[model samples]
Each structure stands twice: as C-alpha cells, then as structure tokens.
Target: MNHLKKCLASLALSLGLAVSSAAAQEAQKIKMGVMQWETIAMTSSVTEHLLERHGFEVEEVEFQEWGVAFAALGKGDVDVLISHPDYAAADYWERNARKLEKLSVASYGYNAGLIVPSYVTINSIDELNEHKEKFRGRIIGVEPGSGMMRQSENVVNEYGLEYEIIEGSGPVAVAELKSALDRGEWIVSMYWTPSWVFQEFDIKFLKDPKGVQEPTETYVWLAHKGFAVQNPKAREVIASVFVPESALTQMTGWVKEGASIDEAVARWEKANANRLDRQAMIGNQ
Candidate 1:
C-alpha cells in the first residue's frame, strides 16, 4: 500500500507540472513605452492593471526623453506608447510616421507656454518686460531640452525681454513655483496645461500674441506596426482608455506628491469605476 501511494503522488506531481508549463506558454505578453512624466506613469499603470485582468502580461519601458521612446517603438522593443504626437513629439512623429500606427487619441487640450501665479498681474508674454525686475529677471523653466523651454526662449527673444532662462527639472520648477506662491512673490515660469500642477496651484498661462506657442495638442496611443493585428484585445483596451482633463490633473497631482503610480491608479479607479468600465467597453467595441 505504501509503494502504491508513492507512485500515485509522483504521477500527480508530473501532471501538475505539465499543466503549469502549458499555462505559462499560453500567457500573452505586451510591452509599452512610457516617459517618466506623471501623466504618462499614471496612464501606463492604469492600463497595466486593466490588461492584467484580461490575461495579458504587460511591461512598461520608461524613457527619459520622448526621442528615445520613439526609437524604442521603431525597434519593436516596446509595443505601445501613450504620447502627444502633434506637439511635443511632432518632430519624432514625422520621422516615424510610416513605422508607427496611431491607435487612438487618449487625451487632448495639452498646452505649453509661459505661466505665472494669477496674482502676478501679468497678462501676456509681451508684458513680461515691464515686470522683469519684479520676477528677478529669471524665468524658471523645466528641462532645458523641453519644447516649452525652447518656446520660452522664442518668447523672450520676440518680446525682447531681458530675463534669464533658468534650466531645471520639472520637480525643481514646481518646487520653485510653490515657494514663490507661498511668499506671494511675483515669478514667471515655463508652464503647460493638462498638468496636475495647474490643478494644484492657482496659476494662469500668459497670453502669446505672436502665436509662438502651438495650439493644444492631442495625446494619442501609438502602437508598433502590426501590433493591433497581432493583439486585437490589447488594441481595444488602448482604444477604450480615456482620461478627462480634470481626472488626469488630479491623479497626476497625486503622483507628483510621491504617490506610487499603482496607488494613484487604484485611487482613481475606486472613485471612477463607472468611467473605467465605460473605457473598457469602448475598447471592446
């Protein structure tokens, strides 16, 4: 009887191992590229959760620069990227247009330009010269390579404002903005819209009469060539995901304050379950 029991146990173990191997082989995997920006992180995390529910193993590849993100997509290292093709990525999109497929426009109304606290009494880019001293002749800007900073330089040159463009990171710029606001001091910084900071702080964009800044651009989901053909359900989810301006601002704001991407996504999902379901439905359709 003991010999029979041992044989039965060995047979069961072999069957179990075979089943596990089959399951692993059947599991589908998808890779997505994302930037370190709060919005990108939040969106990518939310998508990851949703895809996992549908039996897909999702991987997020982080790229510091949008340029690198595009290259990864071209090389097929990453499958998808939720990005703004018309504005910040226009140059890259132009180069990779044939290589990538735009699946859907995920969000819109992204604006980039100079901004200041509403109390600063500045209304337009041209008016910066008069209050240059009040702002300490410095325009706090995000990364030097950012399109916003480049446009800011144009604004300075076009308006002939004698201000220095202080190049710092996004977090540093936000910190400076918060400090200036706390002290009720006048300050100008290269800022944008559809950002969590806009919702967190009472700030306004300075008008640009010369149209140096482009109109609001739509952020879209770009897939590697033939990704949709290979993974229809995954494409559906990308199509289904939609983040309104308000929700995006609030969620990204949380991430800016050190919230993990998953935490922020969970919080948003708990509060917006209906919206999440709707997005899924849209994708399936």
Candidate 2:
C-alpha cells in the first residue's frame, strides 16, 4: 500500500509539470506594437484587451516619439499602431502608403491649434498682432519636429505676424505656457487638444480666422504591408477596433487626474464594455 501511494504521488507531480509546461507554451504567443502617443494608450489598451479575450497575448513597446515611431514602423520594429492625423504622421504614410495596410479608423478629430491662457484678453489669433509688443513678438512651439510647429511657422508667415517660434516638447510647451501665464506676461504658445493641457491649465485655443489649419480629421489604425496574410486573427481584431473622440477625452481626463497608463486603460475597459464587441473573434492561434 505504501509503494502504491508513493507511485500515485509521482504520477500526479509529473502530470502537474506537464500542465505547467503546456500553459507556458500557450502564454508564449503574443502580439507586439506601440501607441504613437499617450492619448491613444488607454483606448488601444481596450483593443488589446479585446484581442486578448480572443486568445492573443500582447506585448507593448513604449513608443518614444512620433518621427522615430514612424521610421520604426517602416522597418517593422512595431507590428501595429494608431496615431493622430497630422503631417508628421502623414509624411510617414505618404511615403509608405503602398507599403502599409489600413486597419480601421480610430478617432475623428477637430480643429487642433495654438492657444493662450484664459487670463489674456485675446480671444482671437488676430489679437496676437495688436498685442505683439506685450508678447515680444515670439511664440512657444511644441517639438521642433512636430507638424503643429510647422503649421505655426506658416501661420506666422501667412498672417505676417512678426514672431519667432520657440521649439520644445508638448509638456515643456505646457509648462512654459502655465509659468508664463502665471506671470501675466503675454505668452503665445503651440497647443493641441485630446491632451491634459486644457484640463489642468486655464487655457483656450486661439481662433484661426484664416482657417489655414486642417479640420475634420480622423486618426486610423495601421498594420504592416502584409500583416493580414501572415496574421489573419490580428487583422480581424484590428478590423473590429476603433475609438472615438469622447472615449479618448475620458482617458486623458484620467491621466490628468494622476492615473497611471495601466490603471487608466483598465478603467476604460471595465467602463466601456458596450462600445466594444465581445462576439468579434479572431481565430485562436
């Protein structure tokens, strides 16, 4: 009886080991990519979770910057992504439009542009001209490589505003705007929405009377040139995914309130079940 009991325990241990190995092998499968910006992280996380439910494991790569991300996509360092509709990103797709595959429309966007602190009496972009002296004829711009900065440069030329654009990243631009506004010193800076800037700072988008900026844009999800063929399941999940402006805004609000990326994403998934389709199944890989 003692020998039989020992034999039974050995068999159970081997079976447990086999089960663990099989589970590890199943978990080893995954999809990989980056969210081009923090704005899309939470929403994409929802898509990621939806894909996971459909039997996919996801690996996230911290997308460093727009330009680099685009270049990386072309080389296939990342497998899939969503980005705002902007010239910086447009330049990438325009160059590789034939090489990249369109997945689905993610979000539709509105007028995005430069803004000023609410305290400033300038309700219009034109006001900058009259108050040129107070501003020292200068404008703070987001990252040098950003599409908005390029547009701001054109605005200066188009409106004949005598000002120089100072280059910096989005957060730096916001910090510069807030600090300058606090001093009540005339400050003109680059701005774009779907960001935490409006939530935390007393700012308003400057009116563009000329309507030079692009309007009514839509952000999209994209995959590599031949992703659909190689990963039919990924394509299926991609097709079922898209996020709207309202959804993105809610995520940004959470970020502004000090929620981490993972936390905000988890909250968005739990709160927005209706927006996602659970029946949409990508084949089990």
**Candidate 2 structure quality by residue, lDDT tens digits, 1-285:** 999999999999999998676545443234455655666676577677777787777887767676666666667777777765354367767776776777777667634687888888888777788988888888988878667887898888888887888888877987888789778877888777676677677888888889776565767777767766566666677677766666677778787789987887778777866666453544542
Clashing residue pairs in all predictions, respectively, total 0, 1
lDDT of 2: 0.72
Cα TM-score per model: 0.82, 0.74
* C-alpha local distance difference test of each model: 0.82, 0.72
What value of lDDT does candidate 1 attain over all alpha carbons?
Answer: 0.82
Candidate 2 segments whose C-alpha is farther than 4 A from its true place: 1-30, 65-68, 75-77, 84-86, 118-122, 134-136, 179-186, 214-216, 229-232, 277-285
lDDT of 1 by residue, 50-124 (tens): 787777888888899888899989889999998888877889998988889989877777788888999987799
Give residue 173's lDDT in candidate 2 (0 to 100).
83
lDDT of 2 at 223: 70
User: Where is model 1 more than 4 Å wrong at Cα?
Assistant: 1-27, 282-285
